[model samples]
Target: MEEHCLFYLAALAIFILMLVMTFFISSLLQTPPRRHKTASLPLPPGLQPLSVLGTFFALFRRSEFDVEPLLRRLHSRHGPVVSFRLLSFPRPPIFVSDRVLAHRALVGRGATFADRPSAIDPGLIISSNRHNVTGAPYGPVWRALRRNLATKVLHPSQLRVYSPARRQVLDVLLKDLETKSSGGAAAVVVMESFRFAVFSLLAFMCFGERLDDEKIRRIASLQRELLSNFVSFSVFAVYPKITKLLFRSRWKKLLDFRSKQEETYVPLIDARRNLLLRRQRSEDGFVYSYVDSLVDLEIPEDGGRKLKDGEIVSLCSEFLSAGTDTTATALQWIMANLVKRPDIQTKLYEEIERVVEKDAVVREEDLQWMPYLKAVVLEGLRRHPPGHFVLPHTVTEEVEFEGYRIPKGAVVTFSVAEIGWDGAVWTEPMEFRPERFLEGGEGEGVDITGVQEIRMMPFGVGRRICPAMGLALLHLEYFVANLVKEFEWMPAADGEEIDLTEKVEFTVVMKTPLKARIVPRKRT
Candidate 1:
């Protein structure tokens, strides 16, 4: 057994060595593109531009999953806009932390920086060759996908149609919490419940029907499996042809996961298709779903053909994923803060009481009148935006900004968390003060869309901003208001204080999942 173990270790070491050699050779063979003589702008300040090995070692020092600290350090040391190369990629990727530069790049020069970098194998395969909105290159296909979502589903009027679904999910969540809390006798770990509830809501929106607990749990489990192993799958993205062969088990796992996803989602897509077919005959009690939109969408860029089943599966997967983990993560952070700061919780509850009548559930219409609820939600997003960085964006053509020449096809990412926490823009940025967003506060009249200027963009900004931003805000406000109004959230009795320490997953979640004592609020 010892001999066999030694033999396997030797084989692994040899494989790694060969992989490094291959990278080195590729790096040497790739020639740098010549810049136009008229456009001799320097690249952003970064590590020694010519040192491929140094760049590799620098990236090696930081875990790919948690690069926030490394990026923070780089921004502090080299100023806001930093650039560095990775492996054999032709151009160095730029990381922008300054809000001003972010505005200029993402808003002012929006078109130039709207394109997405070419996807690696995992992204390409999972997105069905960039068929989904988030993964598609900035082109006709992206426009079509995004327009469908924004117009047919995410538009404010369309979102109002899902209020009943939201209320039903909220009831389930309250029941689950009430059961676990046991009249404040027990402390409940709420992240899983939050995640499951949000997934259930999104699943309903995606499939246009109420899924049973078993099916919702099954689908959520599959998605959680994918997210949990996402970083591990990155191994298959690098030098995929070789790594897929070398990491055979991981490759098989990726394929198996995709197969399972297709198996699960295709039936739902077909069901929606069948519903569409029947709608022509009897248009009775039909609610339009996200899948229905995808089923009917014809991409002008793709020869006007309707989306294939694989693409629909991918689109539905994107819809569930984009809405589920991020919103659930935000809910956990917001509720955790409420538990930690009873004063704020009390203030928010008072506002809810003033707006919502006793014995009546908080309604979507009631949310519009609750200013403090919006403030609390905004503060949660500002302090703990789900993603620390936006998805990497690429340049459509060479452009110059802030004296740096951004080459075409170069990857650029903005620091969403860092920008939100900018001390210059936010007062006592680290503290959770919802009052800042109230009237006569620093955050008053702040536009999250970044149209005028980017004070704090939790949902991002500019053309590529999250299309579902309105829906997400509505969910947050409605859920937070109802949760606070129904229960008094307090620190767990088990001596576990609310810990705000963060850990990176699919989103930045509480390092310690929130376990809070909940007492049902009395009504007069």
Candidate 2:
């Protein structure tokens, strides 16, 4: 009787504890926004103070309202720069739409403004903050990874080396489009088709081997799944102590999704490790790809000198996420926009036709003489910058700005989309004008090489800018040149109106995928 009573008591105690934790989590996730800490004052005039719930609901509605349009409205109400909550974090990001502040945040400020904030919910964990190059804290590790990426994968010389794969992927894409067009499938969502093309190019670059079409598609799907979940509330939920206990199911899904992603990545990684053992380093020569470079990379970890398999997998996930979607989505948006405006499409088509003629293959080197080709891509990036905010930056040091004190670990972010479309910088901010980048305009002084004063940073900027930018552009230029040369893309049987509504999944993409009718322009 005594034992039974004690057991019941302990069980009841645990039940009460769990009940309290669940309630705590629910309330924590439901934290009021205005109660959150924000920089005092500097609140742009006439802006209503946003509560935690208001900020959450506002951004939560973006999938419906779209990021750009929603931000535009917010900018109007809050003026250029304003404070808003992200996820459920008490301290929301200060979205800087003011170009001056944006420039200062991205390029002007030193590491003080660029580092990841410790208080930001998901970012405190070493894994969320450190595992990969992009998430790596703004420090030595970031530099090492950036150096490796710049030298090995994104160097101009390295880009020159992969020209063959670019040509091959374009050829495969055109062949697939030709077959699809002939099959009377109405139209292929050439945007996704473009993604497949970019994927093939990047996968080959990353894995150093050709993946079968089905395998590539499977990988793309997994990547999209991983990306969709990455920056979501699940990660942030894990940070809040109360929600951490309550949202166990959602958190488990994030882990499961991550594990599922690893399911796709591990096989490729293992295969490459095996390839490294059997394959000879030939002088004639077997080109070392990104995976090969990573294989050779050695990073110090807890007294061991080599990167662990898990770390390598994580880094590869970052690589796949950064390189694939940015390139593929940019290509999709560009193609869709061009289809909408036939005049631009016609000029682009004529330019490619002028050079490539009947040959469906457009080489990377071939893009050199076509300034219009470069402009079209520039316009694409400018018009539809992939990420609206360049991954929330954190201040690592106490800094003073605009008569306000910014303490250490404040989450800072610049409105990347807003800056490019700012009326002060470019005329007709909303217009898709490739002409802005012609011979001696904004793009003339622009460095296609990346890593300079980022005029249009779809790839981001500073020490943490994407290492795959060069390869992404090569993929874009090579494939876009070929695809346009092959097909005069038009809207589906529905007519010229292509749905441009944006959806933020992996990257900002057409909510309705670009399904277009392809009238073959080049001789099959």
Error of 2 at 451 (Å): 7.8
TM-scores for every candidate against the unseen true structure: 0.94, 0.82
lDDT (tens digit, per residue) of candidate 1 on 311-428: 9988988898889999999999999999888899999888988998878889999988988899999999999999999988999888887878787888999999999999998999
TM-score of predicted model 2? 0.82
Best by TM-score: 1
Among all windows of ten consecutive residues in candidate 2, which has the lowest summed lDDT? 119-128
* Candidate 2 lDDT score relative to the true structure: 0.69
**Candidate 2 lDDT by residue in tens digits, 1-524:** 99978975675456446645655697767754342243463433323445444443454354454455656788787676656444333344566677566556666675667686543444323144466777777766666666777898889987777777777777787788878877445677776677677777778778877788899888888777766655554334322554545445756766676677667778887777777788765645466778777777765555436566666777776776677778888888988887898899899888877887575466666788788988989889888988777777877755665544454666767777876777776778788989988866666767533344545667667655666766677777877787787678887775558888888776777889887788776365
Q: Which regions of candidate 1 fall more than 4 Å away from where they truly are?
A: 1-34, 37-39, 48-65, 280-284, 494-496
lDDT for every model? Answer: 0.85, 0.69
